[model samples]
Target: MSTKMIFINLPVEDLNRSKAFYEAVGWKVNADFTDENAACIVVDDNICLMLLTKTFFTTFSQRPIADTVAATAAAYALALASADEVDVLTDAAVAAGATEEHCPDKRAQEAEVGMHGRTFIDPDGHQWEPFYMAYQAA
Candidate 1:
């Protein structure tokens, strides 16, 4: 089977700020798909996120978009190469204006469960979780 690429689309209140936040998390924008109303954030070789302005995004859906600030329909989670990478990326996100979803102490408590992750809410109120876990072949 051929590999399928993933493209996650998110509506943003401010395109520039959204683009900056993604950049802070170490994602590069694919200029070929970027414009005033939208930006293509390259998450990895197989994953990409389309950050679209609410006005432009409305064209793709007939239903009213949820106000991210007031409600969230989904949480975008990403898996990283290592636990340290999760912290590094999450720290950068916080420095870039993202609010931490869990406190440092809570994260420590969660690590005891065998999975490690950091969650942050972006400027547009979209939730992003970066996590890491090691897998061993049986």
Candidate 2:
């Protein structure tokens, strides 16, 4: 089987600032897909995030961009290798200007079930949950 790719498109008020926030979270930018109005951040070989300026984004979508800060635009839940890794990434995000857990209940994952995670809101109000699970299904 071939590996499929997932590209998440996000609208940002400030392109440069958003790009810098993702980088501070330990991902690198794919310069080939980035320019003045948009940036492609390579989260991994299969995942990428395209941060587009609001003006540029409207060209692709007819609907009004949701006010992420006021409402839930999306939740990007990431599975990491271990609990420590989850903490590291979330910590870096917070240090890079991300708001740490607006919803305190979301800060911890299913710890009783051997999962641990931390939720954070990026500078642009996108929510990200980095987690680790002890069990894996076949």
Candidate 3:
């Protein structure tokens, strides 16, 4: 059998605050399973962000939780249909109080050729990148 990613669990200090941050950036919660300590932020039809309060998250693992606020060990990147979509999403993130880490810019040297991308940091400093590729005909 093949593996597929259905959910990503992120530990947060405040569940409500994390939910609000995601909501501001156009994500909705899965009400069927979300609660005061855990919220499922739907990213797409197959992707979801499981936001769990620190205390609740500890129940699942024994490893020390990474301090997201002060560390940059990982990031989430999303692809859009067009370069304009990247700008639009980045703008929405800014309006939602997310810090813009990198503005959208073209990278002709990469495999995407004329692609553009931007990065933003969520409230807890989780990095997210939105990108669009303009591929040349082979």
Candidate 4:
């Protein structure tokens, strides 16, 4: 198969804010696929994140919109180049209004699994974890 492209669709309360948040993390907006109802974010060469207004998102599914305040619909994890890079992504997310109180605890988790990561909740309550791991051959 040709190089598979990954598209992750997300529901957002405020498209403008979400757009700004992702942009703060260094991802470019894909103008060709962006409009009033949705903003397409280019995460990488083949990865795209489609941020849709909650109302617009409803048209695609029959299930009720997830109550991000009371519960989580999903957790997205991004792999970075190193432990420091993971911090850079997470720090940017926090600076852009994401919640990331899981600090030293997150650091402690790294010691147990040989991985480093941090979890942050976006303004709309979407959870994201930026991580790094070195997998050595056995």
The best candidate in terms of lDDT: 2
Worst 10 residues of 3 by lDDT: 103-112
Cα RMSD of all models vs. native, in order, equals 2.6, 2.2, 3.1, 2.1
What is the RMSD of candidate 2? 2.2
Q: Rate the local accuracy (lDDT) of all candidates.
A: 0.88, 0.89, 0.81, 0.88
Q: Give lDDT: candidate 1, residue 47.
A: 94
**Model 2 residue 98 distance off true place after TM-score fit, in angstroms:** 0.3
By TM-score, who's the top model here? Answer: 2
How far residue 16's Cα lies from its native spot in candidate 3, in Å, is: 1.1
lDDT value for candidate 2? 0.89
Candidate 1 lDDT, 45-126, residue by residue in tens: 8999999999999999999988878877788888888889999998999999999887688677656766688898899989
Q: Please provide, for model 4 over 1-138, each residue's C-alpha lDDT reduced to its tens digit, 9 standing for 90 to 100.
A: 559999988999999999999999889999999999999999988889999999999998999888886787888888888889988888898898888957797678676777888889989888888888866511
Cα lDDT of model 3 by residue, 7-28, tens digit: 8888888888889888877888
Q: Model 4: residues >4 Å from true position, as ranges? A: 103-107
Query: Which stretches of model 3 miss by more than 4 angstroms?
Result: 1-5, 103-112
Backbone clashes in model 4, listed as residue pairs: none
The digit string of per-residue lDDT tens for model 2 on 9-123 reads: 9999999999999999999999999999999999988999999999999999899999999988888999999889999999999999998875545434375567787889998
